[model samples]
Target chain A: MVVNGAAIEFKKVRKTYGNFVALESFSMNVAAGEFMTLLGPSGSGKTTALNSLAGFTDITSGDILIDGVSIARVPTEKRNIGMVFQNYSLFPHRNVLGNVAFPLEMRGVGRAEIRKRSLKALEIVRLGGLAERMPHELSGGQKQRVAFARAIVFEPRVLLMDEPLGALDLKLREAMQLEIKQYQQQIGCTVIYVTHDQGEALTLSDRLAVMDKGLIRQLGTPQDLYDRPNSRFVAEFIGLNNIIKISGSKHDGAIVDGLGVIRFPSEIQPSQGYLSVRPEHIRRTPTGGHPAIVRQAVFLGDAVRYVVETRNGAELTLAEPRSGENSSLDPGSEIAISFEENRLIHLPE
Target chain B: MKNRPTTLLLLLPAALLVGLLFVLPILGVLSLSVYGDSGFTLGPIRELVGSRVSLVVLERTFWQALTVSVICVVLGYPAAFFMSGLSTKLRAYLVYLILLPFWISILVRTYTWIIILGREGIINRTLAAFGFSPVQILYTDLAVRIAMVQILLPIVVLTCLASMLDIDKGLVKTARSLGATPTQAFVKVFLPLSLSGAATGGIICFILCLGFYVTPALLGGRRSILISNLIDIQVHQSLNWGFAAALATALLIITLACLALFRLLTRGRTEFSSLGVGR
Candidate 1:
């Protein structure tokens, strides 16, 4: 009912692109200075939510409040929110200085002050020497930095990024991710970043809302979603997991199921009657528990992913460390399966 | 390195055509403008500068062409922007509407203008039916300007619209998100980005206006005679090839100079290469 430091609130926001609904009664609270990511696949209303906050698109119904003020009728310019597009929309005609000075100019800052502020922002993004260079002259990474400098020069209320790093190569993308995160922290600017890359969302966001089919499947910290996913979709989407469809209920310590009674000491009861376990938590046993056959084993650098066949005829994935010669398991080799009961998570069916 | 021969071969046909038609004729004209007269003298060249009639007609021609070019650019930019903002299907339909007049013969278009601006044309008839005396609208400077602008408007609009389409909409959206009003965004970003195309269009319109004869002759009485009309008068009525050649050479030289100035203005800022105006 209560959230801390949440300056922006979306109260049942809905957006419809003609007959098809883009976002349906979506609601979330973005805390001030908290890096929140709207994590979802395409058509999942993640962008719709970010656009509503950015005022690029209108909401069919409901109110979006920023700092407790309703910004529903506010124009995009008046919203004073910086946005970095996927393509890094730098003004091609203007030099780097002009691009960064644009927002300050729009605010009616004096010529000298705009220059000072623009230079400062450029310096903040570590692009001081490239102030006079045109956008086309800069590399992709430098262009994004110019975009970032232009964005934060005016000190907007909230920074919304719609897959800003989607255009960069993997190596550059990871580097920019860290740089932008540090920049956000240094400025203490509240940011709402939208990305489909689960790794990006997990690495950058303080909290994230995983969306599916225009609905928020779950909202929590990265570890919370990964370790204790509230829904089956969240567990499957967040990270690699061995999600077994076990009919179970909360018992003394964990959910009791027909195949195996995985125990947990958690005091809360899971209502949906399911248990989830991370792939690393489940291990192989030698002939005591349920009999499973190794279907496939992939040797990663330090990790091996195994596709094992359980006795009840369900396939489950198990991950183990590559420690010795026995690390690689042969397919069709009979083995037993057991899970770390203490690390099991019980979710609603 | 290997791309050079292929590129040159690809351009061979156009290069040959330019050499045969444009370069050769221009060279012949230059030689004739001097040599066709007595002893390759500068007498005609000197007379061109000293003659009050030639100077007056040349000045009027340049001013009229400049005015028409300005009007075309001013009117065409907004029209092009509106066209570019349209949906693909609607834009295609609108482009067809613009090119409809272009496909019609320029002589026909000039005559159509004559029908509209003549003493007993639709406008005068309508005014007469309203019990007002018919105004003398035809054979005036205004008629010539209107006709020239109407004939050349499509070029300006298409040129500007092409460039406007090439502009990334994301830049405008980014400007708006940075707290710029739509007007500011257009003026600061879109306007500057589209300048070279607009300039190219303006220069083309100016050059085309320089050699305008049909519209001015059909629409104007005497004072509105441009250099092209004067050249026609010298050749047909006066039968003076030397003076006509001199005027044609002047028009060519002035047009090229204006184009050079335009290129200088747009150099390193915005390239109008897509407009194909360089050739």
Candidate 2:
């Protein structure tokens, strides 16, 4: 299918409610057909960004452009944007067919055409057999599917989802995450999805923007964010990582306070910054590594997680996969943990 | 099932009050309609059917009530919609304003209408000052209707407002996002959801208008006399207790029938069905 998706750009968009800044100088460019997720906790302005793009709330300054044309003055109806709310927002009085056909009806499409397209959209969402069922009769997952069908039925260029799967259970949420990605790919529409769920964002987004305090802290692919997070917030927010403080740095090595000098790869600049290492990247050895006392060892079914305190008093978490040779260690056992110099990411101060 | 007796015991006081004060009096009136001095007779029914004045008064009462109710709904619905959109603090103040006249005695309100709509009332004086004729508005159907609408307006507005407020605001936003203009969103989504409330308010106003006594008696002319005024004439001037009891029974039956019809129409309404947020 040839998807006529439009590229969207936010140019220094700032929004404020009185003195409370919901978005401050926010700017991002989403390529056509790219699924970009704005992931953040509540009060981080991700929803505000989505709402502003959808024309629900006007920005205090700057502009939003779709396909290189400014739509700052356009109203929500004329924006030609599809939106699925977290609560589903299906019309209760309308059955599945009527709800999906509403946008086409509003556009003054013929009754026959509306029915055809509505059923087709329902089929896209895998809810084709439920056209006669009212919104109240449907389960939570069905309601959200109907909402998704209604949003895409009109062939909107940009699909904005505001935590659409937040109400579903974990298993259903995971299932819908893959479904949403597949649907976005099939439609070829630029999708701006907002959610606080890190796993969902990573799973569904082609590129994800991590937002904090009305600012985009980091924007990149999921692997880039995971392997090389730019800041302490992104490193901690994405996955389990141990951030070791570096007391000093030289051209070839960094001096950790508790541990001795640690060598870095030549490409990595030895600066006065923290070193971040993933829990799974740390290796447990018998000797010839940094000595640490195991503080806690948790027996997860697939992996054993160890919280070890180094001789310098800094705490580190290491995850060891369950294997035949590597046995689970107790809390008071002395262990030597080695870090892969290449895997160690240098974060600026 | 085990708590049924306790439930019945708790409801006993209300049931006894209704049986004594309401049901017994209505039953007495119904019995009085059939019984004569000697024995049971259909004389009151025959008289009610035969009297041209009573027929004319009954017809007038129905039409006037219907018209007054339509006026109240048309005027009250928009007022209620406007109030629903206000901030909570402002809406509370507006609610107090709408209910201010309700707190006053109906007699006092009717008297105030007479003062405002009389020949030398505020409206005519203002018209005369603007170089217009001083229209005779008092003791007319128009006078009665004006007074009735003003008195019954607050109830209609409040009911409509209550229903409008119950609608989830997300539905409107969703409609708008689905390419509906503001007006379209309201007509297609908000208006349909709020119609049940408006219907309830209109039915109440219509029922209240059917039983109106003081407003019509005080503000209407001889030609504009409603069924209640005719019932009064039967009891006092004609000294016909049977005919008066029959009229009372008819009014009671009509009000109950209207309530039943309203119930039937609104039964199983899914006005709030779409409001399930699933959270």
Candidate 3:
């Protein structure tokens, strides 16, 4: 099947519910055939943005364009954007084949073509044999797959998914994530997915926008946001990080009030902010580094995580592979911790 | 398992009430239909079959009930649809409005329709002021149907609204996202899901219509007398208890048959439970 991919653009879109602003001046250009995710906590406007694009919610201002044409005034049906909701909203009265064929039927596709294409769509989702089953008879994963089949049967230009796998179990969720990514690739349709799971966003999206308080905090590739998050929120939200408050600037470093002066990378503009470093970046040394007593050691199967408090009363967490050298570090043991200069990320307050 | 006796004991009061007041009375009526003064006889059954007036009234009763149920569904469905679309606060107020008639007795409501549809009533007086002649609508089948629909409409509307509200709003949104226009989405997705509720409402309305006595007696002419009124005449005017009992049994059987047909039509569908009818 030939899938049409449309370039979607949100040109300063804003949505407000009375005095509450759900989305404020949101703007982004999604490339054709790209799988982009809007990752945020609940009430962060990620779903609102997706709903606005789907024509489910009207924007208070600005415009949403699909394929360079403004669809602000277009009704949801005419928008031709397929959406899979968090709960699979399959019509209970219709069987699997009828549900899958609904979009084609609505678009005036002939009866034979609807049947043939619906079966083909079900085949794509590996649900061909269950065509006669009602939605209530299908398992959760099968229902989700049927929802996917229904969404893509018409080969819409854009597919919007709003936490479609949120209701599934962990194993099914993981498998479906891979399946969705593969389907997006095979169909070559532009996908705008909404989710709060950072791991899911990182694994499934070509690029993602991290949203907070109705604004985009950062928009970049998953690794870009993970490695070089522009804000403390992004840094903490993307992955586990130890953030040390920068009290002041010194001659060649920044002063962390209790941890002494920490050297800053030359590229970092010195200011009152925070120094963020991944837990794995902190290395345990035998001596000649910051002297710290291990407060707690947690065995995580693959790695040993040690929470240490420095002599200056600053606490830091470090992780190390469960090897013979560092696996037995117990609480209250005096250890030294150090970090590479390049691994220290400077995030503005 | 030990609590089964306690459950049965707790159910004793309701069981006794149904047995004494309902089951025994129905059994008496059934026996009265077949038994004469001496012993078992089919005299009442033969009279029910032989009487043209009884047959005409029964046919009229069936058609009247069917028409009234159809009218109730037609009027109630749109009102229920509109009510379901309202916000909770607004919907609560609308439900109160729909149920406002329930506070008044059915006889009082039928009487109010009489005052409105009478020759010199409010509507006819208004028509006279507009220089239009009175249309003789008071003692006609139209008057009884109007009165019946007015009294029974709230039940149908509430039932339909409950079913429509039970439906997931997201299904309609899904339909729209699947490229169905608003009308198509309503016609294809919403209509089918809520039909069970409408059917429940219509069935209730039809059953209620079948037993209608006061409205037809007061508003209907001789030609519009329904089965219930005819049974009333047989018992009171003719002093024929057996034939009246026979007519009552026939009406009961027809009502059960209608209910059975409805159950068959909605078999295996769980959405009908949302109607809060038929368990």
Candidate 4:
């Protein structure tokens, strides 16, 4: 079955429980067939936002639209959405085929057609041979596969997943991430994925919204957020980042605590907040620049990570790609390092 | 797991206590019913089968137990469902409320039923004030059933509630998201999962009802006597110890038969006991 994804809109949604606010003026627009992810730590309203879209939780005041029609008052079952939970909540009493065929049965479809479509969905998840296995008889990964087939069996235009891979081990989780991306592409459903794992968000999302404290801190393509995070929270949350405090304001140069004053490029003003830099952007040299002593060095198969202390006592981490020409550095060895000017991201507090 | 004998040894004390206090008395009663002057005779059994009053009382007891069990399950299941949906704190208090009446002695509670249903009792007096004739409610089959159901409702409700609590609430949410209406979700998912637990509660209520003597003796008429009451009559009024032992042994067999039947139906299926009910 081919399902053209629906466009979802959350307009000024705010949800509160007595005194605690779970979501505040939350809003976003998801394009049809786009894989959107909500990435945040626990208690960051990422789950509340997903629950609001699924109609599992009532919004205090707002409108949720699917395909440009209001669904604020629509009941959950009438919304015709599919969801996969963290534990893969397949009915413990139902077999794999019975679970996958549940949506069709709920819709009063013909028996033969339900069986045919259910088997087809299982084949998509590559579990056609285990259709008759009860849920408890299957392994964890097999249960996850059944959950995926059950969610997409009816060709729902919209699909929601709440940390669907949180229960799997690390290696299996990475494998399922690739399979999930493929399934979403094949079904062409507008997917809303919620997770706290930044790596999983980066790997599977076409576009993502980084949320914190009941608000969306940043929303853009994965590359956009990774390259240019607008706030301190997003910059620190996305990947390994080095944020140095800017002590004083100066257009040409800024006083940074521990590290002495540093000069900025022409037309770039200094902000009295912090300068965000990636570990790879800092390079080590044999001479010149700031003199530093390597405090620690570890090889990570593809790269060598160095944590060095500057002459002014500022600690900075650097990642150098491993190659034949550059030898690994040892701890307590004297070295020189410099930050790339173009790669520096300055944020005003 | 490495010391199997030691683990088994831990069960010896409780097993011995149960054997001494429970199994020995049951053995004594069984032997008395069969071991006649001729040694291992079936004379008591023959007499029991031949007696007309014993057959009629046994049938009445079976039907009464069946009706009461069905009523308890039908009525108590919904109450348990409503309780399961409540907040944990409120549900805890409500569970206490349901069990509060149970702490009082069964005889005391049964006597209260007499005051509520007697000829000059609260119900008949209320009917008389409304210009209706006072109805005879005490010393009748209805009076006995009403009191029996009242005394047994809590057990059924509690058993049903325990299994309901074991269910993951996420399954219901998943069902609704998969396009099942709330009612459909309950019928197709929740009901089947909890059916075994409810059946377990029904069997327990039936077993307890079969051996009941207090409520029937106090509230029932001559036509409403059960198996236990017949054994009471055989011992007290007729002064027949051997015949009473025969009656008691027959009741024991029927109760054990119901239990064995339940075990047979649920032999390979461990979900009911696995939920930690009846523990």
Model 3 over residues A103-131: C-alpha lDDT tens digits?
A: 99888887777888988999999998998
lDDT of 2 by residue, A147-170 (tens): 999999999989999999999999
Q: Candidate 1 chain A — worst ten consecutive residues by lDDT sum?
A: A252-261
| TM-score of every prediction relative to native | 0.92, 0.94, 0.96, 0.95
lDDT of 3: 0.91
Regarding DockQ, does 1 or 3 come out ahead?
A: 3
The RMSD of every model to the true structure, in order and in angstroms, is 4.6, 3.2, 3.3, 3.4
lDDT of 2 at B167: 92
How large an RMSD does model 2 have? 3.2
Q: Which stretches of candidate 4 lie over 4 Å from their true place?
A: A249-251, A261-266, A325-327, B266-279
State the weakest 10-residue window (summed lDDT) of model 2 chain B. Answer: B270-279
Q: What is the C-alpha lDDT profile of model 1 across B1-279, one tens digit per residue?
A: 667988779889999999999999988767666775456766556667777887788998999899999999999999999998999999999999999997889899888877888888999999989999988878988899998899899999999999999999878888899999999988888998898789889988998888887888888888877787887887899887667677778878887888888777767763321111111
Q: Candidate 2: list runs displaced more than 4 Å.
A: A250-252, A257-260, A266-271, A324-327, B1-3, B263-279
B1-279: candidate 3 lDDT, tens digit per residue: 657988779889999999999999999999999998989999999999999988888898999999999999999999999999999999999999988989999889888988999988999999999999988888899999999999999999999999999999999999999999999999888998999899999999999999999999899989889998888898899999999999999999989998999999889764332121112
Q: Which lDDT tens digits does candidate 4 get at residues A1-349?
A: 6799999999999999899999999999999999999999999999999998888999999999999999989999999898999999998877788889888888888878888898999999999998777789998889999999999999999999999999999999999999999999998999999999999999999999999989999999999999889989999999998888888856567787666667655376685888788999999876777889999998998999999999988888899999886678889999898888778887664
Reference-based lDDT, each prediction: 0.84, 0.89, 0.91, 0.89
Give lDDT tens digits, candidate 2, residues B82-194. Answer: 99999999999999888888778999989998889999999999999999998988999999999999989999999999999999999999999999999999988999889
lDDT at residue A261 of model 1 (Cα atoms): 48
